[model samples]
Target: MGALGAGIAALGAGIGVGMIGSKATESIARQPEASGDIRTAMIITAALIEGAALFAIVVGLLSNG
Candidate 1:
């Protein structure tokens, strides 16, 4: 159950990241001139989300271990 739960958490994270990428791409396409700022914000947001996902994965591993 521990590994199963962790896998599910990761699946959700993947979906969330995909969604963020899609939105960011659309935003950048709409305003090419703002690409720099949009890219920066998108990267920051992605990093933050990925960090939280990593933390959850670590906790899940420790708990399951």
Candidate 2:
């Protein structure tokens, strides 16, 4: 169950990051001048999502232990 929980967290994070990247790319295409800002925001958001996923995975493993 712990492993399953961790897997789900990873999957969710992957999806979230992918969506962020996709939207960011679209925004950059629409506004070439704001590409820098869009890319920066995308990276920060993706990092946050990854951090949360890591925390969740740790909790899940600890619970099992």
Highest-TM-score candidate: 2
lDDT of 2 by residue, 1-65 (tens): 99889989999999999999999999999999999999999999999999999999998888887
Error of 2 at 7 (Å): 0.6
Best by lDDT: 2
Question: In model 1, what lDDT does residue 38 have?
Answer: 88
Each candidate structure's TM-score, on Cα atoms with residue i matched to residue i, is 0.88, 0.95
Listed per candidate, the RMSD to the true structure in angstroms reads: 1.1, 0.6
How many residue pairs clash per model? 0, 0
**Candidate 1, residues 1-65: lDDT per residue as tens digits?**
66776777788789888998999999999999999998899889888888888887777777886
